[model samples]
Target: MNWKGHITLGIIMGLPFISAPEQIFLLVAGALYPDLDHDVKSEIVQRGLYISGGLILVSILAYLFRPEYFNVGFFIAAILSSLIYVIPYYAEHRGITHTFFSLGVMSIILGYLTFKLSIISPIMASLIALIMVTNNNLLGKSIAISVFAWVLYSMISTSFTTFQGLKFYIIPIAIGYLSHIVGDCITPMGCKALYPSNYTFRKKEGFFGVAIWALLVFYVVKLV
Candidate 1:
């Protein structure tokens, strides 16, 4: 399925856990982000960059107007912008990043950035970044990811242990990302969700999309 279908499924699977605007944004963004390696031309990726840019603008506004959240605003923008750009560049379609290990690593990195970095903004930024991975038209994704990979080499290596004070808000990112990988199982070349397992769910590829959409509608009703 495309980003539209994937994003819908992701949001549906995620709505039960969301009550805040930040989570909502991140959840939808996460749904569209995993496809950065598959289809860089997808509209969701561009939309995500717009969203990220908007957040950065918001951060700047906060820096000038809402002094209380200024540091956090910029921090959130910076962290998210970095992550969104990095994932797609290093990862190929259905490559290592599509695996459970990569997902776990991404989640851990997100958790550390959220807590160890000071609580709220890092997670939000990570969510934003994930969405923006699709934004290859601008190539900001490439440059940003390269710089981030080099700069955060040491920190990323030690990130798994940094989740000291994480909360429930981050669950959406994990769930949405998982939803993306699973949804892609409806393709001829199945995703590398388990990496070394070398599995493909071609049998379910044709009609599974309908099932996902059904679930999405069901979840949307409940959320409403």
Candidate 2:
């Protein structure tokens, strides 16, 4: 899937947890984080440095100024989340970043954040996870434009209200991350989600992809 499709899948997967719509950005971050290990020439690495840099600076300021309330764990974990997911310079495209080990580490970090902090810190942390430069599934500015449109549409049209905020946030972070791997599974280049094993299988993209999208649309309708 392209970034637009991955992000749309992330939103639909995370739709159940969304209430105030700020969470959608966080979900988008999680959805795209799995592709964090890109070559130095990718768009995210070149253009997204500001995002990750700003996040690091913001996290530091929050930690220094609001030590009583700031979630230092989340900040640290967020940086670590990005660092841990990247493959070494010699690895393949969907290398360690797409592995189950990476997912488990991320889940643990996000899970700990959920246990310790308010939802806002986790949102920042999600953005940090998206700091890497990857080469696959990128779209043009159209991707960002489409993401904005979809979120706006959901916010305007959906009736699902807020619930347990922390639980909702954490659950969807996991789902968004997994949803990326699932989306990549259908591609000709399948993901190494299981890790330590060359045992991933590719799904036929034609009918399989259509069915997944159809199910997502149906689920979105149900959410409405």
The best candidate in terms of lDDT: 2
> Who wins the TM-score comparison?
2
Which runs in model 1 stand beyond 4 Å of their true positions? Answer: 39-87, 114-165, 203-224
Query: What Cα-based lDDT does every candidate model obtain?
Result: 0.55, 0.58
Q: lDDT, candidate 2, residue 153?
A: 62
TM-score of 2: 0.58
Query: Against the hidden true structure, what lDDT does model 1 obtain?
Result: 0.55
Model 1: pairs clashing at backbone N, Cα or C within 3 Å: 80-125, 84-129
lDDT (10s digit) by residue, model 1, range 1-224: 77667666666565555444345444554565566665544455455456657767777788899888778745664656556545665667777666667666665555444444445465455443443444543334433433343344434333211112454435656666767777777666777576777765454642564465456546543332
Error of 1 at 114 (Å): 4.6
- Model 2: per-residue Cα lDDT over 9-120, one tens digit each: 7777666556644455556656776665656434554444445456667788888897776776657755653343333333466777566576666655554554454444
Model 2, clash count?
Answer: 2
Tell me how far the alpha carbon of residue 194 in candidate 2 is from the true structure, in angstroms, after superposition.
1.3
